[model samples]
Target: MLQFLHICNLALLDEVSLDFEAGFTAVTGETGAGKSVLLGALSMLAGNRVDKTIIRGGAEECIVEASLHVAGNKQLAELLDELELPPCEDGVLILRRSLHRKRGGKVQINGALATVTALQQLGEEWIDFHGPGEPQKLFHEKNQLALLDIFAKNSTALEAYQADFDQWRGLWREMENLRTAERLSPEEAEFLQSQINAINEVDPSDESIEQLERDFKRLDNARELGQLSEQAGEGAREAAQAASRVLRAARELAEIDPEADALAGRLDALIIEAEDLSSEYEALASGGDFDPSEAESIAQRMQTWLQIRRKYGPTTEAVRAKRDDLVRKIGSQTNVEGQLIKLEHRAGELEKSLRKQADELRRRRLKGAKDLAAQARELLTKLGFKKADFSIEVETENKLSRHGHSGCRFVFSPNAGQPLMPLNKIASSGETARVMLALKAVLAKADATALLVFDEVDANVGGEIGAAVGRELAALAGDHQVFCVTHLPQVAALARQHFLVEKGQDDSTTTVTICRIDEDKQRRESELARMLGDRDSKSARDHARQLMASV
Candidate 1:
């Protein structure tokens, strides 16, 4: 239940703080008294979308805040916990929304920054707003099925069935993909096979290709290389001969003079070095002969390698990778039949399971529908629709839906003589409002939420029926908080908490104000009379007093 609301700079409201309590509350005022503005501000607190234009002319921003006592709502507490929001102290949940003219808006739950989606989710758990021109969930077919499931308490069963159904659908999709792959034409298969064979015949290797390349270069320049080596040998031989002749003369001189032993030693060293050089030149000239046949063989092998490289890849390693990929693809194609068979079998089993579960769910739903129709009929009778006929039709579908194989349609006849038809087709706004109220009255016993707001629920209702509507709302307040915006005085008289919304204007500005009424029964009677009739009417005052007393 809402404990308090503080609003500032919102539309015609400059600043106001309202304290709320449990039970039925009513807001009553003349037309154009900013009643809708108050509701709009409250809606913002309940996480409705905000527009910056609602800010007062001189204000830079607008703020709407609410404090709720959520002691009895464990579901809402759990949701807050899931969002990692701060826990409520003394079971109080504080929600605040602020909108700025320049920057965007911000939302806070329990003083923690929260996204709009998170706030809206938490708000839904705490409050439900029924406003004019707003679509009603009960009238939607999907909502009708969900309501039946809730009434049956078959959520677990329904979830189990849906899980199997999803698995079945996934398997079916996989089977379709496999079938499509299998439908490839013979030309495509032949093309793939040719590519695989071509890659295999190349038999390329990185090390082998590198060695071939080196041999090809050497062989291609064989004539030049041989000439350079021959020139080098001739140079070494010429130098060796020149040194030998000089060493011989030096040795002879040394022999003739015994005092020249040091010079002779140097000559002996030079002789030895010249002999070693001569031997090296002889080895170089005598080394293996350069054969033109071997060179031709290397060139031929290189040409073969180049041909393969140009046709397949720029490098031998790239060709090898492509070959591996083709091999894997071929293997997959060869085993595709077996995989298809396995998937088909799995899909069949899942379909069986899905059908079994869906059938069981349909049975439970049928039973639940019977109970829901009976309850709705009873509730409608209490709301002054004495001869209204209501039924929940559960039609089985060939395929599985999220809510199993059953589709729910809530059929009704507003008058005694009329045949039953869909609620949307048969009921007027007034009849629909009453019907929705009656459903809410019944569902309230099962719904655990703390607050429910009805915006102008008295749209097309008046007279004694208005009092009955008030009575029903008052009864709902026994266990839940009810906020009703009404024009009918009979409904207003039943409110334990009464508020008056009055709009005032200055020279260039308009302001809306909400005032809590704390007056005597006589004063309330005078106000009710004003609501019922023009200010100067004795009969209207007497009638208003009677309406108040009756409530």
Candidate 2:
């Protein structure tokens, strides 16, 4: 519900501030008294685009600001959270927009700088306008289907159907991707297989590669290494024999003199270490013969390692990873046909399930459309459409959509014996407004938008029928906060709050002012009397008083 509105330097409204209540509120003025300026200010709050001309004659900017009470609205809270804006405090949300002559405009929500797009999103969840151009919304097939779904209470069933449809779509996309993959040419298949074969033949590993490299190096210089080992062994043996001779001499000295005991112990340790070194060198000298065949095999393996590196990567690890990936790809390619068949069968099954769900939804929509159209037509009579024909037409197609297999259209004939046509193509602005009103009245409990503003809804009607329209709007307020810009005293009299828009001039500058008159009974009655065509007539005042009494 809207709590307050403040407009500054907008068109004829130089500056106007008014508080609003959560019920049917009427704004009344003569045809050219600038009542539409109030609607323009609201439209701006709803994120509608405005030109610089909307700025007052001498002002540089136009500002539209509103405070709305939006507590316990989960969808709204979620949207605000998504937009990263301040949440409503004490159930109040402030939305402000300012238009400048040269700098365009700016929007703010709850003190945070926001975008017009964000305002648009929040506006959908907050207010719904049902005026001249707004009524065309009902002509859209998507909105028409939404209304029918709401009236039918098909949320649970619709959710289930949509979930199934989404699953089917997922499967379909996967199958299509597989089909595309399976279309690979024979050359492509051969290339993948060859890469796998090349990597597998080497079967590379870090330890195996290191060992091969060592073996290759030793075999390549075998003759030199063998001769060097033999010479080192002879030298080590001579050194060991010399150490043994020294050890025997030292032992004899120790036996002769106790002072030589430490020298004798050191000679004993050196003799053992020299003997071990001599044995190790002798083993290397006679280790094994280097065969030419073994040399060739090691060389070939090394060559293969080099080739694999150049082709795939420069490291054994990279080659191994590439080999593994190629194996997986070739495996998938070999089984592509079978996978495609399996997916096709699964998708077919899902399609059958979706068809059944679509049929169920179509049936429910057909029933709901019938009932909804009948209820709206019944209310249309009360809104001055005595011989009007209104119907909700549902056309079922074989193809499927997120909204099921049925398309909905609102068709109307304002006079008897006329062919029913789609609302957008046939109904005039006045007729469309009234039809929207009737529909709103019929679906009051189901419509969740907090604010509903009706403009030009009382067009081309007067007297008891105008009062009937007023009564319908009043009834709608039970479920929504309603604002109607009306020229009829009957409608204004029925409102819980009444605001009067008046145009006045001072020094060639014209301005429009809006103020609440409902607080003062005489002022309200006088406005109503003025609407009745004669504010000072005794009969008109009496009539206005009677109308107020009825409320």
Candidate 3:
């Protein structure tokens, strides 16, 4: 569960920190009081993208951090190990995110630097968010199928089907590529072959190309190099003679004065260096003589190498890669018919295997759909959907898809005698919210996420129905920590923990603050009374007290 949340320099929130526990926690505030700011903080913590404009005015960055108690979650432990993040100590995992104005943003897991993707992967295991917009996503068939799969516990089956499908798709693409190559015109084939032959004739390698370049330069500048070598050798010989003469003089002086021995040693070193320089110059002068016949051959080879580089690559490695690719394509063109027959046979066998696995998937979905609908219908009664008729229709298709050969749709009729139709076609936003809550209530145990967040899920619900929504949320809290952002006093009255968000401003800036009021009965009542329309009214407070007592 999320044990602590801290936000700094985020929008209207300069800084805020809250500690939470396992239970249904209600967050209540008037419109524009910055309740959404709290949701925004959680969203950023969940690895959602954020803009720099969300930073508080005059602030350089915004930060969101959370601490979770994950003592016995084996799944989270394995994920942490797989991502190479630091493991929990004494059942605590810390996640931190910071967004800067100019430097972008960064995510951290347990103090170890991590990517937003890693944070998201880990977040999925610990937190689940159901905001107002999330219910709309349920209208899509893909989301419906995914929910069914979760209920069915189809991980193993799905993995098997996906692997086989991936293999079949690869083989299919390869066969198509071969067919395309086989369809090339004679002119195209000739052009490709010419490119291949050019590279093959050169037989370029990194080391060989470098040596060829060096030899070409050396042979081309042979005459000029020979003249310079002679001049350098003459200069070195003269410098050596001069250093030798000075050393002899210094040696004579060293016999008279011992300090002069150091000078003689320095002159001796200079003479040795000059002699080595002269020897190198002499060697270069000798090698500078090149055979004309050899020079012509090297020049032609060098020109060919340059032309190949300009056409196919700016480097030898690129040239080699292009050559290999052309060769492979030509080979495929030559034996395309034979390879196509073999690949087609393999694809057929794999497609049969895929169909078999997909059949198993369809069977599981069919079974899971019935069970899910039955369970959800039972919960819908508790959420004030007394006569709601809900069912799932699994439609199987003839072709394979990324998911499977079957898709599922959520069919619903909100009232008795109403014709059942697709959820997106008939259900209102309020109905959708309640339906989603029912499904979530049914799947709470199957969901491993420790924290469940509902941002204004009771958007259009009020009065007794709101009370029922509160009860359902409270029930969900029996096993998971649940948070609801709501406006209903009845809902607020039932929370094990209640937080009040208030927007305040001094002359210079505005800020939103949230703090727990569950410990103060009068304060809780006052907040609930405010939600009832008038906090100062004695009657409202009395009603708030009564609501609290009933809960």
TM-scores for every predicted model: 0.67, 0.89, 0.65
Reference-based lDDT, residue 187, model 3:
89
Q: Measured by TM-score, how close is model 2 to the native structure?
A: 0.89
Output the worst ten-in-a-row residue range by lDDT, candidate 1: 281-290
In model 2, where do residues sit more than 4 Å from their true spots? 81-92, 110-112, 204-242, 278-321
Taking the tens digit of each residue's C-alpha lDDT, what string does model 2 give over 1-551?
99999999989887878888889999998879998888888888887767788888989999999999999888999999999999999988899999999896999999999999999889888888877765345668788788889898888888988898888788788878877764547798798788777667666888888898888788777777778887887787788789888888898999999899899898878877877887887777665356778778888878887898998888888998888887787777787778888878987998888888888888988899999999999999989999999999889887877878888889999999999998777657778789989998888877788999998899999999999999999999999999999988999999999999999988988889899999998999899999998999999999999999998
Best by TM-score: 2
lDDT of each: 0.79, 0.87, 0.87
- The candidate, 1 or 2, that scores higher on lDDT is 2
Tens digits of per-residue lDDT for model 3, 236-256: 999999988888889999999
lDDT per residue for candidate 1 within 1-551, as digits (tens), equals 88999999888888999999899999888888988877787678767776788888889999999999988678888898899999998999999999999898999999999988888888778887676654466768987787788888888988888788788888878877777764435677677777667555534776767787877776666556566666776676676677778777777887898777688787667756766776665565544334668767777777766776786679887777777776676676777789989988998887778788888888998998898789889877767687889888999898776667778899888779898888677446667777777777877766666887787667666786788889988998997899888888988999988888888888987888887873567667766888888646898888877877776
Clashing pairs in model 3? none
Tell me how far candidate 1 lies from the true structure as C-alpha RMSD in angstroms: 7.5
Off by over 4 Å in 1: 47-52, 71-92, 112-115, 176-334, 416-428, 505-509, 518-525, 532-551
